[model samples]
Target: MNSSRRAQAIAPFHVMDILARARALEAQGRDIIHLEIGEPDFPTPAPVARAAIEAIENGELHYTPALGLPQLREAIAGFYRKRYGVEVPAARIAVTTGASGALLLALGALLDAGDEILMADPGYPCNRHFASFIDARPVAIPVGPDTAFQLTAQLVERHWTENTKAVLLASPSNPTGTLARDEEIRGIAAWCAKRGATLIVDEIYHGLVYEAPPQTALAQAEEIVVINSFSKYFHMTGWRLGWLAAPAGLLGGIERLAQNLFLAPPTPAQFAALAAFSEETAAILEARRQELKARRDFLLPALRELGFGLSVAPQGAFYLYADVSRFSGDSFVFAERLLEQAGVAITPGVDFGAVAPQRHVRFAYTRPLPVLQEAVARIRRFLAERRA
Candidate 1:
């Protein structure tokens, strides 16, 4: 019995492996403070929870239409109109099991086997794997400090190949937490349009921005495929609900794939997510957003005081992708030591991409303030002792 070669080519999620290792240590009495995972520490808001409860009570837990409930689709479209002022019709939206599902649908619908899809280095690793799963080549365009670890139109032009069928990127990206500029996004859209390439934007971190709001590719072109989720800002990770807004013409192919691949996204999650858009949930989440902002403020200076050099002040996402080469070039070892000695868990950059894996580590500030403060204190002590 043999597994598919494609399955062998992809690696397991490195960050999650470390998280599991840390948890195992904790079971043996090590008090670990987790700053590794990207998930928010908050739970789903009360209104959203209540919506799920009502749906279950009303016996609405049955499987829905393959595309999803019409009301939920309409509500998602209205959300875009109100939130980003982007006019998207319900017919163009496909609710997915998660942003991961949306990515698979987009890749399966858009690319052929051996077709190339350009993505920035240090991007979310799953984007690359999703391409691999479909027998498509995920071409890594090395975007370094010069590009702020983001994909630009110039880089796209430099790397564009005849086989390149699409471009994928995340604003307020996963490992880097760097948000691509609106002008940069517009330029990429124009460049892709001219070359007949599809533009896929992952805006999952749109609402978690600090200092300024993140830009949506939908504002640049109506035909682009935009993937968003209720997981991040809405604190609904476990519910497993997300959506993809693609061109009206692409909807048919996407729907066909969804019908076969997923049947439909979870029914209760879709119904529950409606409340995530309500004014009441918005007010509740705004306070959580501000709390994340404060944690960012607190952690930035603390990390610097501990001598962690950061490339830039992350403007969105609750992460600090710090340069840890000053102390050691091996981030995996550094992360291990931080967890074992300091009782603090952080993610190694190798999980993101191979650009400069040994030199970087990412810390998520999505935990409670007290927990983050204690982790900072422990890290500071670890640094001081090493210096002494």
Candidate 2:
């Protein structure tokens, strides 16, 4: 039997495969320090969890309007108003299953079959797959540490072809954890606006920032679509809830796609996420952010001391994309051996892109400080033993 060719064209999630191996090792009673996955080790904030419990008890799980719960949409808008001082009408927000759902809706509404969406390489693997799912091409612009692992206006201009449709970028990006500077995004938005191309910024890691707070694309350009989540900063990974804030001109098509795609996002998750923006929850998340920041600080220097080549400091999110070329020629082999021989798990850069794939690996600082310290000690010993 044959499956969809689209399914065939896409590659497997190599990180997940490594995770499965790690889990198998764990089941066999091996201790694995996981710096591989991007998920926050922290659970959902207590208030948010309680909200889900209450919603479930009340049986308030009915299908919401395809666009999402109006109150939640307003809450998201209100959040922008308070957090970024940007006024966004609730109607322009589409709450979907997750960031992936938001991406699906935006890509569906924006790109034609042959359209090309531009993004930085060494990016989230799912972003390109999301474009592929719609039969649109995702053009990867190779980015290094000089521009902080982000796309510059110049690179975007150089990559623009006749089929180019839009640009998608994530500030506090997944693998690298580097930000697209506010000025850089503004310049990209202006260029895209001039060309009549859409700019979609994935600001999911907004609240998770460690350095200076990142200004939202909505704050910079009123119409550039921004994708966000209750997952990362809110620490609600399993909730499967996120939102897309699009401009009024594109909301109708996005709404239609939302209506048909999944009927609505999980109802209970929406109810639960309502608590995510509250002051009590904010305090809790802030504390977790500090914990993550501490972990990042500890691991950054430790990796460098171990001879890892990292060009830029990760300003936000919980990842460090380190070049492992000094340690081994192939990062996949290095990652696998680290997991198997040293009981440490990290993601190979090949999972992110074809550009200099063998040279890099990403480490997530989602684990607690002590655990990270232990991982470092283990890695230090592993390198010493290998070199000896």
Candidate 3:
């Protein structure tokens, strides 16, 4: 009745909007300590930056093939081989503007209008937007702490329907930061295989995990879509570079979609991203990962000590999604109060889903240890005052 049904069906990302507001407030002289946005606070690795500069000076800055520069695709493919021990051909990889572009491309390639795609609730909100953008239904599978806030094989099986064409999942998930087990991934893949449903895995946070590295979805299914980015692990969010590795068959559709949608990833970013696979860069990023792990270690225990309950122990990513219902039932109100009263900004879990949304908040521990420690101290003071 009012505009396209698609537009009305989706919700805007509230946490990002709140983060923007908090940033604006900081710009107006408020000392808002940002734990809201999920961005790493590190500069890009020097080698990666140097590569982009060289490419710009050398004029390798023209539009590339839609499937991305062959060399970059080869590099991404090699990344899979070296990191995952999976033999992925360069032909199966497409460099997109970022993981965002990859999500759009994947949804366009796989979904038809009015089709249904299953994704875990309390998951990445953008997945729902992507599905809605393409006129597909994003069926939220209500996942909670009982399953580590993940979409398990049993849940997938229970939710499958005639219109369900795909299952989209993120490992080391965005809000909760919990990685799905390998066996769980395999089971979901096998279940999807039988039902002709596609499985999409978001591995953007793969390199940031504190525990052992996650088993990629590619290891389980030949037909799944895998997305990764240089934003999180490589500290290159502004670079806007990421890649998607799909089954050999899906390459044609994705390439065509990417060609028309993005033309190609940024020429300079792609060139720089090649160096992202270098040994020196790898070592540098590993060091950064260790630093993030340290920040997480500091923030996690401190939050618990200050009386915040965690839905799941985050084994990876730079986020700690804590249950703050004891302090304030409304996460948005609590986050706002934290920003205004305590100078600490955080993301409300309500942005992720409606299930117990008001009870949680996500704190990004990607900043330096001192920053996180200060934020924790401020939060403790705020909670202590509230209790009094």
Candidate 4:
């Protein structure tokens, strides 16, 4: 028997392999400084944790509707109204296993086999895979620092083909951490509307913006499908809970797909996430967001001083997509050597996409200030030794 071609076609998420290698070295007593994964180092907020504990004690573990607990959906809707001043009805929200689930559902609902979804190169890898899982062509248009590592309305038009059916965007994108301008988002939405295509924006890192107030794509257009999660902003990665807001026209299909695919998101997690929008949880998350900003501030200069080429200071999320061409021509080899020689782990650019990937790497500032300081010091030493 042979594995299915679809299964074989998916490339490995290289960072996981890097993480495993880092762990192996740690087991042998090496001191490893991890700057690889995008996960926040903060614990889940006290209110959320308490809610989960209370739900468990109260035996609120039974499956709710496949779309999610009605109250939780209402809470998410209220969050949009209060935070972004955008009105999102609870009926349009579908909670899922995580942002991953939301992506799967959105792609599943929107894409047909042989259809095409346009996305940026150097984007979150799983997105491309999601399109592939359903036999859709994921067209990756290469973008660079000139556009702040984002896709613009012009780029979309230039790349559009007869097969293109949707456009997927990630503001405060995973590897680069750069956000699309609000006007550009509006422009893209307008273009999609003109072309009679769907627009899906991944707002998973919505709450972590630094340079400006966080804006929801829902503010730009209600028809836009917005994907969000408890993982990044709420510090609940392990809980595996997320939600998507679909326009009324897409909600029925999304709900039907959610019912068939997920049955329901984790019951206890939904109960716990109810507290995620509370004032108490907001304060905790705001403090952590500031801490993340501080980490980015600290590490950006430190890495530049160590001779890594970081042209753009990321405006959101906890990553710095760096040009490592001065140090090495290939990012994968550079990452491996850095891990083995410096005991520091960071993700290589190959994990993102194939546009000048050899010249780039992503540094996640998901560590404490002191740890990042140490990683910088080690990288400095590594560079000096390699030069000598």
Candidate 5:
């Protein structure tokens, strides 16, 4: 069988591969501490789970409208209004299978073959691959701690080739957990608007911030679309649901594509997600957020003490991207040794991008306090033995 060029161009998700190996080890009775996954360790809020079960009992298991349940769309719109003080109309919201589906529709509709989209090098790989899936090239802009590991207006201006069609950004980004500031996002959005390009912001980790809350990009640029998911802060990873708030002009095309591609997102999941925004659910999620903060506070200093280079600490998300050149020149090799010797699993930066990948690794604090502590202890022992 022949695979398409698009399939070859898209890189495999390395973390999932690492996870599979870790699972293999666990099957052999190994006690592995998993810090490689990106999702929260928290359970779905009881209300949301209860909603799904109730909906099923009531036989609300049919396909939703192609754009999603109208009420769920309205709920998502209302969430932006209440949380970010931004008025997002329900008409502009398109619910899809997940953030993955939303990205597929957005990139597929907006880009033609050979079109270029700019994104941070050390970003969510899936974002870049979505462009490649549509035969659109994703230009990786190398970023560092100075830029908070986000694309800036200057980077956009510098990388604006004739074929550049759009910009993809993720704040409180994966791997680094670093955020793009509001002013910079505004400037970049303005640049894209002036150049007739589009800006797509991934806000899936929006509700998981440790410091101040993030300002919505929707508020920054009217022409931009916002991508968010139930997977991260809402603790609904397996539910595979998310929504996109596209500009009114782009919504029709995105909706039409959604009709053909997905028909609708999962009906039971849609009904359940209605409770995700409730006050009771918010309380449950906030408590878990505090726990994540505590884990970060403990692990950040612990890793530094253990001599991992963390020049700029993370502001959001459950990850800490560290420079491991001091310990090993190759992150993937070091990660394998760490897994085999210490039984602590993590993701190598090669999974994210080619920018200094050999020198970096990402640690996700998706485990509880005790589990994280145990992983740290094991890592400390592994480093000690390596030095000896």
Candidate 6:
């Protein structure tokens, strides 16, 4: 039997293929410097790990309420109150199975068959796929350095159609590491409100911003849905825990979706995440964020020196979306050759979207400073040899 049409329509996440190839090369004795995946290199903080161990030992493995444990939800709300100075009530929070689960619940709650959702091209690919899963149309608006590779209220207005039902966005977005300005977020939220359309903002990279403090979209508008994960800033990628804060009106529907789709998020993970907001964990996460910022500072100029066109400097996140047109017309081929010949693994832009993707590639500065330096050096030699 054939798979469903929706399953067939989902495009493969090409970075995973790049990662698998990189791993194979490593197994065959090649020194692979991974700049592809967007996961942090740091381990989960001590306090968070200890909490998980304690929970496991105490037999705290029973299923929690589908919406999540009451304490964990309150902790997430407290994070918003303390971190972003926004008061999100615990009742509005739903601890999800990673941001992916939150995205599914949000889309499932908002979209119906034949609806349309607007988002930026070269955005996180899964946003579109999530819409597709619901039989909704995903309209990708092309964005570039002109708008910091982000969506704006004006762009949303320009792209609005009779069938449009929602808008999805990410600050400190993957593949680009660019953030939408706070004012821009407010504008977009207002626009969506005026139209009675839903707006979902991915804030998984919230605490990882450099140059200035990060702002939550919830601060822009109380009605907006905010999705966050412990995976990024907390260095807990493997834990598969995330959460979403929705308006009080939407929480009931989201809870129903969460109940049916997820049953509940992992019990041990929920317990462990309680410590994610602790002061001790905060210090460790802050140090890792600084380390990531330094890597970005180094890789940005190094890649530019090697002839990659990086028009916008990323202010946060651990990725640099570089235009590789000068070196190679096709980013996928460039990435493959770089991996095979130079032992450096990066994601091709095609993985993000179809907006001039052939000319772009993404570098995730998730590796250490010295490892990034070595990747840069290898690319330098590879380019020189190709020129000769």
Instruction: Report the alpha-carbon TM-score of model 2 versus the true structure.
Output: 0.98
Model 5 per-residue lDDT tens digits across residues 1-388: 8798767777887778788889999999999999998887788889999999999999999989999999999999999999999999999999888889888998987899999999998988888788877789989999998998999999999999989889999988988999988888999889888878899999988888899887889998898988999988999999999999998999889988988888889999999999999999999999999999999999999999999999898999999999999999999999999998889999999999989999999999999999999999999999999989
Estimate every model's Cα lDDT from 0 to 1.
0.89, 0.91, 0.88, 0.92, 0.91, 0.92
lDDT of 3: 0.88
Better of 4 and 5 by TM-score: 4
Candidate 3: RMSD over Cα atoms?
Answer: 1.7
**Collision pairs in model 2:** none
Q: After TM-score superposition, what is the CA distance of residue 108 in candidate 4 from its true location, in Å? A: 0.7
User: What's the ranking of the predictions by lDDT, best on top?
Assistant: 4, 6, 5, 2, 1, 3
User: Candidate 1 residues 93-153, lDDT tens each?
Assistant: 9999889899999999999999999999888989999998998999998877677789999
**TM accuracy, model 3:** 0.96
Candidate 6 residues lying further than 4 Å off, grouped into runs, are: none
Poorest stretch of ten by lDDT in candidate 6: 206-215
Across 1-388, the per-residue lDDT of candidate 2 in tens digits comes to 9898988989988888789999999999999999898897888899999999999999998999999999999999999999988899999999988898999999999999989999999899999999999989999999998899899888898999888889999998878989898788888899888888899999888888888787888888876999998889998889999999998999999988888889999999999999998999989988998888888888999899999998799989889999999989999999999999889999999999988989999999888888898899899889999999
Q: In lDDT terms, how accurate is model 1?
A: 0.89
My TM-score estimates for the predictions, one after another, are 0.98, 0.98, 0.96, 0.99, 0.98, 0.98
| Candidate 5 structure lDDT | 0.91
- Candidate 4 minimal-lDDT segment of 10 residues: 214-223
Which residue runs does candidate 4 get wrong by more than 4 Å?
none
TM-score of 4: 0.99
Model 5 TM-score (2 dp): 0.98
